[model samples]
Structures are given as structure tokens and as C-alpha cells.
Target: MLILYTYSFAHMFKTSSFLMISSTEIGKYIRNMGMVCFVCSLLLIIFPTCGYAAINTSSTLSIGHTLSSPNDFYELGFFSPNNSRNLYVGIWFKNVDPRVAVWVANRDTPVTTSTANLTLRSNGSLILVDGKQDAIWSAGEAFTSNKCHAELLDTGNFVVIDDVSRTNIWQSFENLGNTMLPQSSVAYDIPGGKNRVLTSWKNDTDPSPGEFTLEITPQVPPQGLIRRGSVPYWRGGPWANTRFSGIPGIDASYVSPFTVVQDVEKGTASFSYSQLRNYKLSYVTLTSEGKMKILWSDGKNWTLHFEAPSSSCDLYGACGPFGLCLRTSTPKCVCLKGFVPKFDDEWKKGNWTSGCVRRTQLSCQANSSTKTYGRDTDVFYRMTNVKTPDLHQLVSFMNDKQCYEGCLGNCSCTAFAYISGIGCLVWNGELVDTVQYLTNGEVLSIRLASSELAGSSRTKIVVGITVSLSIFVILVFAAYMFWRYRAKQKEPTLGVVDTSQDAWKNDFAPREISGINFVEMHTIRTATDDFSSSNKLGQGGFGPVYKGKLPDGKEIAVKRLSSSSGQGTEEFRNEITLISKLQHRNLVKLLGCCVKGEEKLLIYEFLENKSLDVFLFDPTLKFEIDWQMRFNIIQGIARGLLYLHRDSRLRVIHRDLKVSNILLDEKMIPKISDFGLARMFQGTHFQDNTRRVVGTLGYMSPEYAWSGVFSEKSDIYSFGVLLLEIISGEKISRFIYGE
Candidate 1:
């Protein structure tokens, strides 16, 4: 049953060199060499007993002989299971421990004895017949008149073919069951159900099909699901044009990359990967415990690298329909906005199956007279950072805006989300199997009755108004008290910033100031609308930045550093001392400064354009910067680096030069911002080495990324990487897979 064999003997060498080898050793070697059994015997004629034999096979089935595939990596043979009288034709890795079985020819009807036979027919099919002359198993329907061949490939794929046509008629990979090795699939032919699927074993001791199965569903979004009987246990959420959102926190740890496809004309979906090293072996399998696991071989044994449904949130409907599962909390169910517990008492008792109900009745049900009555009363609530719900209707041949309008125009739509590269997906019924994500995914907008929305809006407006009135009252009272006190006192330190005085008195004494006055908290609160969430730009180690416009219509970015934020304070001081002294179009300009109680703020002239990463790394924005613009960005970054290293007065080294720190002006000019990590070198100092490294990976130079040594040359190496990034539009860490 063995397809091929490999044998080497020392007798051939002994005879050719006229060196004597023991006669008994020669006979033993000849008998052990199965492929060239007679060749060894023939060599024994002239060389005495000093001969050996090696073997290879094309298409041969015998009582004892077997086939070791082309690369001799695996062997196909009839073997009995552990503690079983039944025999089976199975393929196992050659010379490896655990003797892992990739495929079984007669898993259900195993051979009862050693006399069981398996053969490759003249027709392209392979058949296994037991000692009782009972048909145990058979391969695909393939036929031939005179020429048929079977071979085992290095990938461990066994194939039956025709010698004349030389086309593979049958392969083990296409009939996969429980195990999915690299290149082997649970689903094969995309448009056809020639799709391979894996069914778990009936039990630990039985290889018969079990209740659990794993396969890809050719649904709109094309999701992979694991089911127990007909019920779905876990789902690899709809592939987000890029990857599955449900499986969060995927880094470079696993070497596998997955792909999904859906075509009405050619319905297909699949996933596959490549090994990091040649010697390592890996595969994905549906374990008996009803879990999908990715296992890899590390020479000695297989290792489990990843698994789906690894947490409670991974279970389908674990939190019930219309409920969100938050893994970070106890009793993980949370109602969506505008929804309340269906059974408050049951929910209090920790029974979440009742799920949630709309807090307000739908306006459509209240009125039937006019069509516009219900249409205008339905509002959409933005749901961010979520793993979108299931059972979707795919709408193709439209852009995001078109999809949005299409869904918005329909009254039956409950929620809708449009993804790039993959058209629109809309859900109309109850949203089920939804989980909140800590990582940023796509957004989903849920439809709610106007009453629910108005309540939410009213609450926000009331909070805003109350805060505004309180601030106004406090300011008026303070102003009155200050005027009366100033009238009575000879000297006053009341209003800190004023042209009447040349300096302000600090706790340490008097300090001269030329920058704009430290604006009162009330003025800033009014100008930036109390640092409202709507006006907020971004939050960092410093508190947050807000987009503020002066009374004169000048826009500015306010960086409000916190009192306890030592890092932010240092960054602020560094930026002020370094950038404020320089005047360059490629540097962020400091428009003014503010010092309030426990708040240190710096105002910079707001560029119409934002940070470089916002555009350059964005999927939609990347296309806007064509080759010409990308090249310009590269050259501009190089110029900025040259200025920092050579043109600047202090010969500064921008230790951090990531896309995030690079800002753009209206003309698309690149400005280097954030000097927190920048280091100034004394005259003629070429380089410096430190024990601590403070730069992003991929962009960090080899010498600097590995160690804390840096210089102008280090910056040059980093620039080279930046140049390549701009040219190829790929991250450095992703360079390994040609990402």
C-alpha cells in the first residue's frame, strides 16, 4: 500500500572501492531495501554481500508494500487503530512522533483484520475493500481506459491522476473531514458545494462523524461558522473588508492570513496561510470540545497558537438577541440605546434571555393617516466600536453614501452599516449576536423613535444650559467682587495678564511675559464651548486639544496639558523652548500660551489640514495622495529631517518621526510637530547612545530599533524607510508578508 520508499546501502560503496563488508550485514541491508530488493540481490552476485537498494513508486498496491509520497514526507498504509481489531488506510507524517493522521480512507468502516485491501483502480478513483470483500470507502468518480497514476505530493496531498492527461482527478485535500492543513480546505470549489467541511469525531475513541461541524456560509458577508447540529455555537463575524471583527487583538503572532469572497455567479469563500519556516507544520481544526483551534508543529510537537470563541462573548447569542455582551463586566448583558429590559424582575435575577424592549412606542403604530408622519419621526443613533450584528441583507453596486441613502429611505431598516471594498449591509429585524469592541471597528447606526431621541437630546441641552448659566453667574459675581476690592486696595494682583503692567508676579517673584495673556477660565470655556465633546480634537498624555476660534475669526488648536501630567508639561516646555524660537513653514507655530489653575495650555495656529497619519494611513485618504503627492511627502519629510539635523541652531534630532507627529498645512506642506522626544546635540557631536529607547517600531532605524544608539546616520536609515513607505504605502512590520 506504500506509494514510494527511500533506501540507501553501504554495500555498493564497499564493492566499488574493493573494501570488505560483513556478509550478514550485506544480506540484512538487501532485505531491508524494499524499493530495489532485486538490485541489492544482483549486486550481491559480483560484490558478494555488500549491496543496498532504494525504491520509488508510481502506481502499485500490494499486500505489504506501501507508498511514501514524492518527497518521502508521508506514507500511506493499512494500519489498525490503537486497541482496535479494525484496520484502516491512512496517511501519516513520516518519521515524526504522534504519527498524525491527515486523512483516513475508511474512517467509518475500518478493515476488521490485517488482510484488508486498498487499491487504485484503472478508473481515476481509489477504493478500499475489506477482507470480507465489503466496499469500505471510495474516492471521486474518475475514469481511465489504459493509463492511471497515483502519487503523494510533498504538501501531504494525495492525488489520483491519468498518465495521458496528467490532470489531478482526485486529491485528499478536496475531501477533508476533521483536520484542515495548510492548502487543505473545509470548502474547496467556490461556486460549487465541492466545498470541504470538517465534522468532529463521534467520540474520543470513535472516528465516525460527530454532531459538530465547521464550514463557511456563503451568506452576503460570507462568514465562517461552527455549529453543533443545526444551531450555530460560534461565528467568525462577517469579514470586515479587511478581517473578521469578532476576533479582536490580532497581531503578527499567527502567520496565517484569511480571505473571503462572495459572488452570485461564483459563490466562494475560503481561508489559508503560509508557514513562517519550512520545517514547521501548522493547521486549523475543529476540536472535540467544539472549538476551532489553530495548531502548529514546533519540530517536536504541535502547539495551539489560537482559538475562536476563546471568551464568553465569542458564543453566539451569549447575551441574547438585542443585547450587547461586555466581557469586562459581570453579568454581561447591556441593552442598546432606547431599549429597556423586557422583564425587569427577570433581568434583576440575572436571566437575560428576555432581552430588551423599546422604551417608547413606535410613532408609525400611533398614526396611519400620512406616510410622512412616521418617516420624519424615526431618528438614527450612532453606535460606535462594535462587532456588527448578523443576518444581513447585502446591497451591492453602490457607494457608502448611496447605501446610507438607500437604507435611510426605507422605514423597515433597523440598522445599517456600509463597509469599503464590500458594499452595503443592512439589518431589518432584531439585532442578534452583537458585541462591543475595545478596538475601533466600523460604525452602526440604529433607528429609534423620535420620542426616544428627543429625550436624549433634551437631557444634553439641559446639561449644557445649566453649565453655561452657572459659569456666567460665577463670572459676574467674581467681576463685581474684584472691582469693589480693587477700589479699596492700592495694589492688586487680581487680573494676571495686562498691558498696564510689564510683568506678572509669580510665587517665585516677578517674571516678564510677552505672550498673550493667560485667558480666564470663563473666556476659554466660552470660546471653546466648555471643551465640549463636539469641539474636542484629540486626547493624549496631555488632557485634550480643542478647535477654538478667536473673536477675530482666527482658528487655533489648544493643547491643554494637565497638572498631574508630567509628560505633557515636559512636552509643552520642550515645544515652547524649541519651536517658539524658530520660524519655519515646516514647523508647528505657537500662537499663544495659557496658564490657569492646574492647567498649562499652548495655542498653535490651526492648519486647515490635520495630522499626516489621518490622511496618509487612511484607506479612503491614501488614494488621494497619488504618486506625485506621495513623492512630495517623502521629499518634504527628508527636508524636514535635514533641517532638524543640520539647519537648526541646536542641531536637534527628532527622536520620534512617525506619521502622527507630522502635520500638514493648507498647501500640503509637512510640519514636524511634538518635540517631546527630540534631543539637542552640542556642536560637533555626531551621535549619542542611551539605555532606553523611545521611538515607534518599523520606523525606528535598525541600530536604534534594536539598541538605543542614534545619530544623523540613524535618521538617514529611518528616512530611507519613510521613503519606501511613501513609495509603497505599506508599514515596515508588514513587509514580511508583502502587506
Candidate 2:
């Protein structure tokens, strides 16, 4: 699955393309414009905005009014929380229910009445004021002298940009809310000792700052921490290469990783995740109860995928310092092998916060020089399937043996874990937040006195290691076999095409398709929201048609061939070959296509008014079209049909000509669509015969419906039927075929 992106300004419009219009020229242009443009100009001149993508200083956004993101993905306006009287200016998803606010400007100072105005000042700033003209919140410091305007991006970032320079003077992304929208990330400023943080809303009804917050800590190797005020509520382990040391089991293919980067020159460390399952529109929200959950919208519904501190065992310092938290254990908390509970009574009461103390001190800590690890003075006790402790220093030791000896040499080193991704990790002080998962966790070796290890038999340790390795190998083998079985059972899926992509080989595909642009399946998924139900327009014999907008905001109508349709492959190839050869203003233009295994899509230039049937068949919309409009549509259809039969390079016959196939463009000009069942005539051929009849039931001609013969005359008869339907507003029911 992929996410549709509208984030970068560079891709939208280049600054060099902007034509600077002076005040005098603007006035001249306004006077010369048409009535609609004149009215819009008046609105922009006076109040500037009622509804639009961007707001200049001349614009005033009042209550009940909103400025929507370009694609209408996000809205910025004054809104009151559920059951709350006060109103605050916030940004929320345009389609989401319950009005989930992502950012609030007036959380602390809300207007009681519905007369507040969010005004952009000449100083390149925005101010929210109530009816009394008292400022609620003023923000955005000017960075350049260029005239700036504000816009809400599809990524949910509110930015002030230089209208001419296209420079980003200020942005709301710098000042984050409880939600981390896509393209937004937390960074640690080492020199300033400040970090970008997400503070939760106080409660469901209030946007005032809450007690819980999530921030990236700038420890050499930075880790994420959810804090309750100054105290840590939950730890997101450490940035151990591709994963966190303490929070394991995240598939790199799905759950994204926030990799750390230390800028030596700038003296700052930052971690940002540029990839998610579908990166651009995904988000992570910090809840009121102080939990981070990652989610994404599939157009209609938001799917929650991952959550942190999911269990009590995952909570920060659940078993306190030098304590281990295991989900399977009866009490869930226990002291290490070489340690005992500091407070025995509290431990028995299941209050293990007091943690544990070493039963015997390490030899190095005692003598400072008599360190003989695993042999005499001190020994390392291995704890498998466990999360390494917090605050562990990154050790540069290359191998496990070197990492072990490096830790053994240091009297202060309490434990060490050598992981492939992170290399080596050695904890100096007391260990905290150590968790034991059932599977896929790092192993931590704890340093202890030799006397504590003397009781444990060498055979038991060797047997345990052997059994763990054997079981791991068996599980991996079984998983691989299961995956293979599943893959074999599943129907073939589509992939990016280089040569007959999706195993859909065509003799003409290699050469004929050289002129046709092939889109990636990823791009199609992104544009159509993974072909969600919301994007679907209508179902036809071919399959379903969906409305989608490309990254450049170009709208396209995609007809996806159903996987189970036995005849779809042939029809798909027919449409591709026919439409690609024909080009006309009255005929639907074929943009491109995507072919992957069972998936076949035909992309067309989208008609805004949709097909003529929508206007003809619908009761309310029917009245909207006058006789003049109907006559124009009739003429346009006639012109399209004439071109298809006479003018096209290929003498193509759209065998499925019907009211539904006659699509109406933005200007209400009819353009013929759907060439899946089209036929072509060779030199001196006027008619074609077929055993199979394939077309919409109502649009089939009598001669073609009964017999196998079809020609230009037969299409003309169907056209006459379509014309009768248009003029009389009555459909001819010709159910002559199964299709």
C-alpha cells in the first residue's frame, strides 16, 4: 500500500514560474475578467477568503469559515470540542469523524462566542482574536521581507511562505502538537539542550497541555522517552542500528525505524523516520494517557497499526533497577540470578519498585585487578530472549568475545550485550527496564561473582544453549515452509513491468506499448488509497471504476479488471490497443495503464461531470440540463461517433456504445469512453461476425443482438437508440445478452 503525497512545494509550482503582478495590473486584470472571476476578485479584495487553499494578509478567516488544504485533506478553522462551549482554532482531518484535532492555536485562550477571526497580519504573522478584538494567540515571526501568505499543507503542516520567493519563513511543524504527522519528526538539538516534543491534550475536551509528553533524548545514542512531567513513563529502548534494544519484534518491512544521525559540525543529534508502510500521510499520536500509537487513514477509516508500552511489562522501570520483567513469570517481576530483592517484604507484596541488590560483589569491583571472567574471579550469567537495560553505552568492541573481555576489564561495567545491529552495549550503573519477551529479543550477559556461578552446572548451560538454537532453527524452517505453501496457494499478483510484467505476455506488448506510459502498481495504490471503497465510482461488466488524483493533482478515472473475469485479459488488451491508436477531442483519451499478474487497470483522463447517464437518469440532475445543453451533448456524441467510424487512424467501432459510455467532460462536451469491447475493420472490411455477444444489455442493437453480424449500420442503430433515450428521457431495454 502507498500514501498519496502533496507535501513538497518544489513539485507543486516552481518559484521561477511565478509572474509578478503589480497592483495596477491586478486591477486591470480584474476589470477584464468574466463575471465569476469578477465576483471572486471582489471577495479576495474585501475579505479575501471564504474558502480557499491559501490566505494572504488581506484575507480574514472567521468562525464557521475554514481554509482547506489544496486536496481538502485538512481544514483549519475555529471549532469547539464535544460538550465544550469554548472555541479554539485547530487543524483537523477534513473527512475524519468526531473531529480529531491535530493542532490547536488557542488551547489556553478560547473564545466563548462564534465571532472570532483568524487574521493574517502584514508582519507575516497570524493572530486569532475574539469579538472584542482581544488577541487569543499570535504566532509566526517574520524571517524575510518578501510578502508572505499562509497555507495548510496536505501533510497537515501550516506554513508561512514568501509568495514570490517561495521561501518557508515559518511553519507549524517546528511547534508540534500531540500528533506527529507525516514529514514531521522529533529532533534533539544538542547545543541548545532542547528537543522537539509532542505533548498530549489534557483530556478529550481540552487541548490544554497535559502531564504526559513524548520526546527524543540526546544521549550519545538517543532513545525516545514518554515522560509524565520530568519522570519517565515509558522508554522506547535505544536506537540500536535498525531497532530499539528494549522494544523488539518490529518488522523492518512494516513498522518504521527512527535512525539516529549525529552532526559533528553542528553538534546535534537527530533521528527521523522517512519511511513507514505508506510514509507521506501516516502519523503517530501521543494519547492523553501517554501512549504513542501509529496509524494511517485508508480514506474512510483510520487503521491503528502499532502502539508502545502495550503491556505492563513494557512500562518503564516496571520492575525497577536491577529487576527483570517477564510476561510468563507468575509475579511478572524477579531479581537476577546473582541478586536478591533489596526489600524482601515489598517484593513478596508484588511491589518490586525497590528493585534488587547484588547477593555477592564482583571480583573486579572487590580487588580491582583479579578479573578472570568465566574461569575464577567473576562469571557472566547469560539471559536470553530479553530486552537490554536502559542507559547502556555503545561499545566499539568488534566481536562477542572482545565485547565480553572489554566489559570484564572494567570494574564499573555491570552487564554487557553484543548485538549484530548495535555491535556492543555495556551498562555501567544499575540495570533498569529489562524485559523478557517470549521470542526475538537480545541476550544480556550479567557480571557476577564466581561463587554465584559455582552452583550452576556447566552441562545445564550447554544443554540450554543447544536446545534454544535447535528450537530457533526448527521454527525458522517451519515459517519458511508455511510461507512457501501460502505463496503457492495464492493467485499471482502484479509487479512493475519491464517485459510482460505480471506474466501477462502479449506478442504486441513489447513494441506497441513503447508509446504507452506504464505506471507502477505502487503509484496506483497511492493515488487510489489502495483502491479503498470510498474511491470506487461504479461497477461495470469489466469491473469497478475509481476516481483518483495523481501526485500533480491531475484527476484520472481507473477501470480495474476483476481478477475472476475470465474474458477480462482479452478485453484489457483490446482496449489498450484500440484506445492507444485513436486520438480525438470527442473520444476519451487513454492516459496509460498498469498490468501486474491478476491486476489490470486502464487509466483515462477523468471527466468531471461523469457519464451522460448520471445526468440523464438522475431525477434532480436531469432538471439541471436544459434543452440547449442536451442538444449540445447530442451533437458532441455524434461528432465522437463520426470520428470513431471515419477519422481515427484505425477504423474503430466502439461496440459498447451506450449512454453510460458517453462521458461528459468539465465543459459538458460528451466524450466516448470504455473501448474494452471495441472492434477494428481491416482494408475493405465493412462488417464483422462473432459467435459471442458482449456488451451492455440495454445498448445492444437488434441485428447484432440476434445474429452474429455487426457493422457501421448496426452501431448507427445503437446510436439511434441512445439518441431516443437522450431526447425522450426513456431507456430502451434491450436485454439480449448475458453481459
Candidate 3:
């Protein structure tokens, strides 16, 4: 409509001019036409969103113009930072308030004029052009004549893509600003010295790099670090299995799951997080005050989830080397047990940066005689509930004992800590950034000279003797009470009516079972530490399984049946009879069974890797098993089923088959277990009917679940469900009908 009006006015003016109109009238008419055209041009530039979101060589995004993300979550064009009038081509959250800019294309080179524009050059480079049309900033890709375009992704990554190849050549994520959105990362290349760090703005109003930076250090078992210029400001500690050792706050309840990807060969590591929930907008920002703050917004306002350098003790090397920082203590910093202040006057003045030095030099450091320089020359003083110090070297050792031995063998080893998920970590140099926690902390053992240990040994001996006597008296009283109670009550035998000794025996005689051994109940009780709760692995339909180690150093899984278990003597007998006869590699080898009165136990070879459900369902562990591993597991399970149904002498039907019942060995070989619900098939038998259903839900066939009609096909149906689970990495119950 505006264009039509302008054209008509131009035509009428030309006609009026030709018809000899008055000079003043012609001038007024020309002024009116110019005002109308200017208004139309301004409207076109202000409202350019006519369902298109792209800019080519011919197009330019001016000061008032904008280019939105495909999902409209982010917008990229021109923005003024804080209170600065200097314009910058940046990306900011569309839904967030106060216009939180995540990425700035020209943070340091801000355009001074409103006529500044963002343009995509024909050479396939995105450039920020000033009023003079001079390029201020460009996406420094090699000049290419190929068709290419720049796009703002919903993930807040601005990318320059090669349209012909549909591949991103450059991205803003690789050059992170102060804020790290979901899927954005802080990457470090140790070998190449290339780092994508989160450097704080000079201040709230400034977008330039500040003194503080958050980056992943290029250390063995790489860790996240916050540095102030060239010095360390805060340390995030080494990455443990699930989280960073120093940051205990990142746990199961955290809003977003933190992930660290490390490539040892490539010498690179990256820290990132996934947006598991949609309502919450989470980002980690490095504040100008040298604090790394993790904040999230839920539509209304931003909430601070966590912040590093949260306490005085969190400051990097707050207590210096060989000094422990305990927030609960009045002074906060103290010298280690075997060490004294290097400079007593400085320490008294609260200047602990001068750390502490060993009071008695290590025997290894002294030129002592060979006999005197033995293991007795030094002892380890155990410090419990403490965060292990920085600059640790990870060593290969099986257990805490081996870790201690390995450290003792090294003369330069200063201290060692054995973490549960992460094994032996030893430090050869000064222990810095040590902090004490109230609970759930690793134990660090500092090596002390024999002279220092001798003073404490006498005290330890006296206390040990006192405690031992007290424990002995208590045990005697407890044993007497147990004996008296047992004497007063009748011993309950197996609930079976038969009272003969043979009643405990199954179809296979003890002598006939060649490989299986009938273990004593006393041994199992000893191995499991008298059924300690700590030793319990998990609970099954029948009973709880406990992890135990035999006297011969063989680990075993003891499945003890509870008195209140749904499966009674029938199931027990069936399991012992069926498993004893089966000898396939994929089948869990039945080491032995114990039938001592009311106590019934099934012993199986302990698989170090535990069950399939553990790795299959765990978010952190699921990546360990790739597609090839899953395929191998599926094939192993199929072979085991084939052996049970067709190959074995006795045809068997496993009524329950699920991820939890599938045990993985040390080598990750799958083994089928839990035969309490298994039934044997007679000759030529194809199917059987029962009034009661006996299998886990979801995996059960429709006919078996509804009508209690089960056969070999029922087991096959369960396998099919298991196969789907292995491929999709989801539980059968979670699978929707249509999906």
C-alpha cells in the first residue's frame, strides 16, 4: 500500500511539473514525498522478520535489525553491552531478562556508530562492518567462494556452515565467553596449547578478558582450575568417577549432569553438561570477583545453584604446602602432623603461604646405613576425612594395602591417598591445597620419620591395649548370651516335613557333583563378616546377595535365602538341581550350596563387573559398553539359552530373564543367572499351562502374563525384550506403546 501511494504521488508530481504548477507548491509536494519514503524505509528496516532468518552477501543486519535462532531462543545482530553505547554483534537469550549476552563477536572491537552492520561476505566469512564499511571482526576462516551461511543455533552456538557440505567450519562454542551454556564446554589441548577457557569480563560493564579464567588443567587425571592471571585462584581437584573430588556438591540431585571427556592420546580434555530438564535454563559463569558461579533460571528469576571459592578454605593453596585447611577450625590453617612451620613468625602472623617443612628429615634423604634405612625408618600417619592434595600421580594398585606398599617402595613419595572409585594416588612433591572435610572425604597417609612416629607409637599401644581388653570382655558376654538363648529355644530345621539327614540332599549326590563343593555355613558367615550390611550387594526376589572373599583369595557371591522369601524349598531344590547340572560358559557357575537347618545359601563365582543392570542403567557407566559390547552380550545370552533349551541333557525353561539377572564377569562376558523360576521340560513337550504366573513384569510374554501359559517360547519372548533393552539403552517398562 505504501509503495503504491509513493508511485502515484511521483506520477502526479511529474504531471503537475509538466502542466506548469507553482514553484512553492512543487517544493511542498517534493518534501511530502521524501517524508513518506523515509517512513516506509524505516518500517522495512525495523520489521524485517517476514518469516525469514538468514543474511546473504547482498543483505546486511543494521543496528535495529536482528537475526533469530531457528527456535527463537537466541538472537544475533547488534547489541550494546551493559551501559556502553558501542555496538557489538552478539548472541543473547531471547527469553531471559536484562538481556544476558552469551556470545560476543566483537567484544574488544566494538563499533562506535549506529550505522554499523553485520554482513556475510561472498567469500564465506561473517564480518562485522562499521559505518565506513570497514571490517571490524571476521569469523577468521580461510577465504572460500563456496556457498556458505552463518546461523545461530538453539544451543547458543553461532556457526559458519558450508552449505554444499552441510558442515560447520567455525563455531562460537570453540571460542567461549564468560558464560557456558548447556552443551557448551571449556576445552583444553595440552599438547597443542589451545584452550577454550571461560575468562571473566573485566567488570559487569566490560566484556574484555579479566584477571580470572576457568579452564581444565593439563594434568594426569585432568582437573578444572580457576586461575588469576598466572597464579592459581581455585582448584576443582582431579576428576573422580562421577564428579570432581574437590566439588562434592555435584551429585545426583544436581540440576544438570556434569560430564568430562578426556582423550589421553590426543592430550585434550573438556568439561560440559547436558540440559536434562527443559524448564530450567542453566549456565556456568565466571564472575569478575574470581568466582565460578553455576546459575539457573526458571522463567521468573535466576537462582544460584553453586559457586566455587565459596569459603575461605576454597581459595587455592589457602594454607600453603603441607598445611591443612579446615573450615570448622578457629584458625582454619594448621601444619600437617609430621611437619612444623617453615617460618614460625610468618605462620604466627597468619602468613601460611610459606607452608611447613618436615621436622625430621626422611631417612631416605639422609645418608644412613643400609640396615637403618629399612621399612621401620618411616611410618605413615593416616589423616581421615580429608581432600587429597593437588599434583598427585595416579599409580596402579589393587587395594589400599598394595597402595601403601607401592608408596613405601618409592623413597621420594611424600604422601599417598587411596580413594575408593579412584585407586592409589601418590604425591612425590609438597602437598598443596589440602583441606579437611567433615565427612565423605578421602584418607591421606603422610609418611613420617620413625622418630616422630615413635613418640605417638607408645600412646597408640596403650590405647590399643585398653580397647582390645574392652572388646574381648564384650565378645565373651555376647557369646554367653547367644549360647544361653539358643539353649532355651528349639533349633528349627528346614521347613520340609522329612526329618532324615537325606532330606537336605538333592537329586545329585554329593559325590556325583564333581566340580561343585558343599560349603559350610560357618565359612560363608566368616566371608560375609557375619552378614554385615556393608557387604550386601543387592536384594533379589529370593534374598539378599553379599560380596565375600574366600580364604584362598577367591571372591564369591553368596545369595542367602530369607525365611520370608516367596520362594520356598521347592525353588531352592530346583535351583540347586538345575544349576548343578548346567555347565555352559555363559551360565553362572554354581560353586556350591549350603543347607544348614533353616539357613539356605547359593554360592556362585563372583563376577567383578557385577550385574548388567548396574552398567546398563547407570548414566556414567553406560558409555563403557558400546554397540559392539551390547551385541556380544546379546549373542552370549542367546548361546546360553540355546544350551538350556536344546544342547543340555535336560531341557530347561528360564521363566525370568532380565538385565538384573544377567551377570557380567571381569572380562564383561554375560552369564545368565537366577534359576528359581526355571522349569524343566519333558520329552517332546512344547508348552505348559499353570494357574499362577511366575516371572518379572514387562519381560513376561502377553500369554504368560494374562493366561499363565508358558513354554520355551515364553523364554524366547523374554530374550526378545532383553535384546530391545540392550539396543535402546532403556528398560522394557519405559518403552511406550507407539514409540
- Strongest candidate by TM-score: 1
Model 2: lDDT to the true structure: 0.77
TM-score of each: 0.60, 0.57, 0.59
Expressed as tens digits, the lDDT of each residue in 1-739 for candidate 1 is 2333236555546455544667887777667776476774455444321211111123434345455665566777766545456666777776667766777776787666556556677666677776676777888565653566676776778887666787877788877767776666655465454666788766555666788888877776777888999999888777655466556554111113565555556666665544433335766667677888876676588777778878888788876777887755442789888899889898778788778878886655422554454567877787756777889888874666677666666766778887533568898878898877654445688878887867777798997899899899879966976786676575555533231111121321222232334455566677688888898887654568898878777788888876554565456656656664443446676776666644667778787778877776679988887776766667677767766776554588777776777788776777777776677787689899888787777778888878789888776776777676667666666745444
**Cα lDDT, model 2, residue 538:** 89
Tens-digit lDDT track of model 3 for 116-174: 87777788887888889888998887666577777677788888788888888778898
Give the residue spans of candidate 3 off by over 4 A: 1-46, 49-52, 251-256, 276-280, 329-331, 366-374, 451-739
Candidate 3's displacement at residue 160, Å, is 1.3
Instruction: Report the backbone clash tally of model 1.
Output: 14
Q: Please name the candidate that would achieve the greatest lDDT relative to the true structure.
A: 3
Between 2 and 3, whose TM-score is larger? 3
Error in Å for residue 163 of model 3:
2.0
Error (Å) of candidate 3 at residue 48 is 2.0
Q: Which ranges in model 1 have alpha carbons more than 4 Å from their true place?
A: 1-37, 40-66, 78-86, 188-194, 251-256, 276-279, 329-331, 364-375, 396-402, 420-423, 456-739
| Model 2 residue 317 distance off true place after TM-score fit, in angstroms | 1.0
**Residue pairs that clash (backbone atoms under 3 angstroms), model 2:** 494-596, 502-597
